[model samples]
Target: MPSREVHTATITSDGTGFYITEPVFYAEPNYEKVNYNNYGMAFRIQAPPGAYSVYVKTTSDAADTIVSVSGMETSRLLRGGSWDAAKLVPKKYIATARGKEWTYTYVNGRDYLDIEIEPNKINTPVGVEEIVLQPIPPQQREDGSLPTIFILGDSTVKSYTFDETPMSGWGQVIDAMFNPDKVNVINYSMGGRSFKNAYTEGRFNDILMSGSIGDYVFIQFGHNDESTDEFRRFGRGSTESMYETYIKEIYLPAIRERGMIPVLITPMSRVRGNAAPGYVYTNSFINRKFPDIMKRSAEESGVTLIDLNSESVKFYNEIGVEATTAVVMSIEAGETPGKTNSGSYANGHPSKKIDGTHYKEALAKQFARIIVTELVKKVKAGDSTAAAIASYLKADVRVAALSGDWSKIFPEMAGDTTTGEGAYYRNQIEKLIQLGVMSKDPLGNFNPDEEMTVGEFIRCISKLMNLEKSTFADYPNGELSREIMGAILVDAYHAKFTSKPKYMTDYNGTAVVPGDPDYDPYMDPGSRGAMYYPLVSWQQLMDTAQIAPHLASKVKEAYELGLIRSEKGIARGQMVNGTELEPKVAVTREKAAKALYFMWVLQQAVKAENDVSSLK
Candidate 1:
């Protein structure tokens, strides 16, 4: 039979894949881009050559939405359908969030699935939320029952939506790396899930219920387990404690009893946090104690272990720090040129902020290859367990090298420092550029004297500290104010230090200010009846009405910490008893560089102190 040529139709996308948007011949002739109710969307499923059933789930805003297979004479009602005819199977329906499931059988391993939306009289916009492609196994096993590989991990291993494009998981593409005709791959991983939460949420139970004997279950976690706060499943104890309580005591035994092979994989390292200057790895989450705990758990449980942490660290280091941004979900405003489903993310949405933890499609595919390649290596090393799963890999599959000119990742800094050899900030600026803490403009000029904005300053600090999930994208690119910069410096300080900074603790001063709640004009003769009130603490001094209430205390802390330099030759409104903050004044690039240097120096002092404590 000849295939249908639907090239003239516009393509509409679901979460992970797209479908053709053909005109709804039965409904209005016009294809409404704003309201999809007047159009039909379809996608052809291409799977391995075999007799199987395709299960689809869809949701729409309109009640009269129809789902039917090709070659059908009339559209079936959403309520009921014949099993033999392959029509709509109503799972459940709600007025606000209506959903339905449909099943279609194919003997030729392919079929055209179409979703038809009709224009509703109520004028409510209609759309399809999700389309899940579930390929049902054949009734009879021809090749001795092919085993399934189950993946259990965090966001780095879960499938992402089309809107979340460029943010893919290794598991999403791992199946393609293997010979699909030989085995099946199912990913049970979810974002923001720790091992404790996953097990508690019955995710493991779902896998055990569906898995059979001789199947492989690959487990990886530990992106969220490091949280110290009570929320997000915190206080679940340390990494070692969680490993012992879950893997050694429970999960491994359960899998072994079920006769399924369990393979433990260490979570991959983050690009920013793990990349150290002149080193393969830094002392971040992966390098600290988590990977060691994973290794110990695998060793004691006698499970096949894959050290993804070490391998990924090596990969990031080889690619260099600046190039790491290419693989991860790090994009500056308007950096990527594709239109998202919402159309808002194109011109620099907040979601486009720097993400060091997640991987883009290219790196995700590479990581999948690395996982399979490691299994192949294990098989070559004569590991019987790895040998069992090595047959599923495609012929001669190898890890691909991350290509691109590394030198071009960050253009050379074009600045003249020869005339200012004695200038203090020149060396500091050079160090910042070399460390990848700062980059030159697209025109290749460092522009050291250019006034830094709040966004630029936050980014520089974030890079220096390797802060994950920095949420300063909304900060405007206008010249940064001293007061706002003070608040941000305190944030950076708290990221590393637990106690109050030495400067804040050492300060002892009081000030007289007006408009205080405790102000009594006639109470003190020293006030001169000007409604003056004594500011007893440094916090009170910085908690002026001009600053936002939430940031006022932080600004005060930053000022006392000596991170904020008092302005010289200040105006009348800026000076308070010869202590001029000039809080509203724009910070120059030179001053910003000096402030960052002070913060870095303080961080080093804390690090040195901690190192000495460790020695003791």
Candidate 2:
């Protein structure tokens, strides 16, 4: 199908008078029937002061080529292409303000205009208008300085003044923080935007043009880009891609274009969950995840990243969760909490609604403080003043003391010390020894630190956990040999305790054959076996069935849950030998904390569904 071609002419105010030009075709036209070679051309002319009749004329155009003139209201049609100059009746088109108004006229063929109209505001049609216009002069400081700062972000930083309220955005707050004589803040931020959409809409271009040299531009986003559309998910890769584009395309270009500096800020933390008086409420809220990624991306991108998330977290922690909640709720309830000026329930969005996600005036001020604090440090260090503005904020360094003692640090591992090589496990081994799940060497010494052999480890875990007796009871009887071990491993595999073997070989120094007398073939021992045991010891396995994975998924789940750490990426298929489980490996407190933490999580999950019926 042939597309319609509409010729458009743009007119703008040039100095005093209006300037009009022909409509230029941006693209070549596709010809069709009716000889629509030229659809038509239209021109925009400045409406003269007061109402004036306007018409168009083409010297050689046929009468069939229609000509029309339209003002702000009425329209007129002309029969002849070229009409007698005196015969045209000019209409009254009142032009007010020093602004240009466009009037369109269709000329079948383009030509220049030399028409004249009466009642000129000024004598020379090309000179300034003589209404003795008093311009509202640009704002000036006592010292006559005009410093500029530009901000780029999503809705949070965009200017949004309430119609009847004095509420403004964080951008406005930021402007207040800086000296107007030294800082002219220009907020290029838009609401409901992401890094990608901002570029698609030419917001970056607008910033570049509006910004001046030495101007600072602060960019904060992440609430929006962390979305999964049809094309991409805001996972690590996609988020990194967008972050890079923001830096290379939007941020860096703006800085280079105006010799300005760009500061990257991680989004402010959302007020999720409840806050206490002396403790900050931190929980597994999903909205909190993306800000960390943004901070990391900013640091990796080498831009000045203001750690707003961490700062907010610190602020929350300092006031105690209850106090924070009181502050938030008080503001939300529209009753001044007498302590903090946190506004009403519109928290997440910029609206007057109290949401946990959005910030109110108080929080915005806090964030501004953080920005300025960091900004000033950079500035004092002889960095760009643009960067200094963000450093002007004062960081809230006071935080409440953490409750509880060091004992709570490893609450989950409080009672379990039997798996890794240590004296406590030695006593526990005796209990297992009596159960026949484990045995000491003939030398009268229980090598408590040795790495367990592949065969021995499997047999012990299987028997101690009753895995073999219950599930593989009908299996071929053997001396708990490699073949039986292989069968048990298969059961474990199916149960998802471990991943499938990646290699295949036999103990006889030969790859397993399907059918051979020497084929130790029930399982492939050559594969890289499970790297870490899910539980540190069989005691843990028996004590907490909640930690158990299906025999197939156990090892994988354990590794994933941080129950076990892999050595050289390989979970050796060896019995628990004393020499391998070295107690002097310098286990840090954090590692113990992780183990205990997961144990707590497991216990909580179990307790949450106490009854067997509930479990079902």
Candidate 3:
């Protein structure tokens, strides 16, 4: 059996064969250290003969380094990646890098892979390890005719080599779910890149250069975007601030201009343990936070959205958290799968933190299948363009296990619960949930009957309206009243509801001192002080609780817009099949969530009609 040992060797820092990290033994006068100012010194791996066809590995959660290899006739492979040990930045198959600067020949007759490691961030360690020369493969055919899907995002979407084994990205192996003869999957995602970074660093620009009209772009960036570090923050200041600006100005425009389709995707949940009984995991980062932002972007930008994050969440819930932990990057020490001739990953746990963030190949395949299933389901359901794209996606086996209803894997979604499969409001319940407008608890229970707290209702309204969380004290909590709901509804839709939210153009307009729209308001507009003493509404006056008597006018307005619903068969905002009751009745989580989703669907309908009008 052929093994990497016979073909690859690590280049050593010194002329003699020795180890600093991995196997370090190679003769090269190209590498030199450069001063890195106050923090630490920097170095470079220069080459004209620069480590041709070599696979580089970086370690310690370090995604800070960038590699630029001067291309020479002697060098076929010229890309650097995150450490395979951490299972990040999957090793390359074809020569690929962050930028499009791979064409420089004979730097003093020495082909070089110039690696410039930036000063490391104080929070984490970063280092370059094993730089192995890869065996040259047969020349690959250039087939621009085949429809290619370029994946863009973070490490979770990058392609991992077989040596990484169990830890794999769905985008890397999603090709198996399609007929390669017709569809080509090119994953350009790097570990730790925010979608914004993908554009800022020129990966998206490269796509503009390479992608043809018929090609597709799948973008799912949130993992690293959720970073607390401002330098790495992509999801930055939630939807309105960083996220909205980037999608509207950069991602959507760039992909659409090339005549290629852009499919916005949400990041999937990690197998972070600590589950409450019944439900597996309850991380809402991807479940609600990022998905909500992306969905809004897709809606405003007119792009298709594939809710992979929601689908994965459903799958995890059905499989149970314990099983999912194992399915992810977990293998009990010696329990690692038998090594293939390709190579083997180091056995056991990399650290005590556990590999909840990554998945094994088997699980990656399933997740890949889930993506295909979603594509096909949407295609058949009246999406002509999606159907056209689906024609290229030829899945046979892996997706066979999942039906069109794979998204409804959870009992709550399937209506196979205390309410039973044939329960009333089942479809409404499922729609609100499958869309992830609402989600079950970590225990895998929807708690549909549980009363909705004032806080919970505000949260649901925010999700439905895609409202921006502006300030620190902007948090919602307690039993909700008509007044609070009115305040929330008004604030959520201030952008389009009452009137299109106007940008602050004048400093003296109100109390603002300087900067127009850029001025920061430190107060929550929906707080009690703001919402109090407004005109009472018909709905509130009707409610004996006298709830929200202060904001009656706005409450009535929201009711007119059909965004509110009480537990009654026929009432304001009662778009769902049936209702619970009249106003003053305590709201239930399920009911509030259902009402929010209904409002969102209605808004989408209005948007579609407006689009048609514009076309006409």
Best by TM-score: 3
Q: For residues 303-390, what per-residue lDDT tens digits would candidate 3 score against the true structure?
A: 7788887888888777665556545655321222112222111122323234667765446656777777777777767776567667
**Model 1 vs. true fold: TM:** 0.42
For model 3, the stretches where C-alpha displacement exceeds 4 angstroms are: 1-144, 231-240, 286-288, 337-347, 395-616
TM-score of 2: 0.36
CA lDDT of every candidate: 0.52, 0.37, 0.47
Name the better of 1 and 3 by TM-score: 3
User: Judged by TM-score relative to the true structure, which candidate is superior, 1 or 2?
Assistant: 1
Measured against the true structure, the TM-scores of the candidates, in listed sequence, are 0.42, 0.36, 0.43
List, residue by residue over 444-475, the lDDT tens digit for candidate 1.
55666667788889888887766642645435
In terms of TM-score, which candidate is stronger, 2 or 3? 3
Candidate 2: Cα lDDT at 335: 16
lDDT of 2 by residue, 178-239 (tens): 55545576666755566655543344434544445556667777666655531321111125
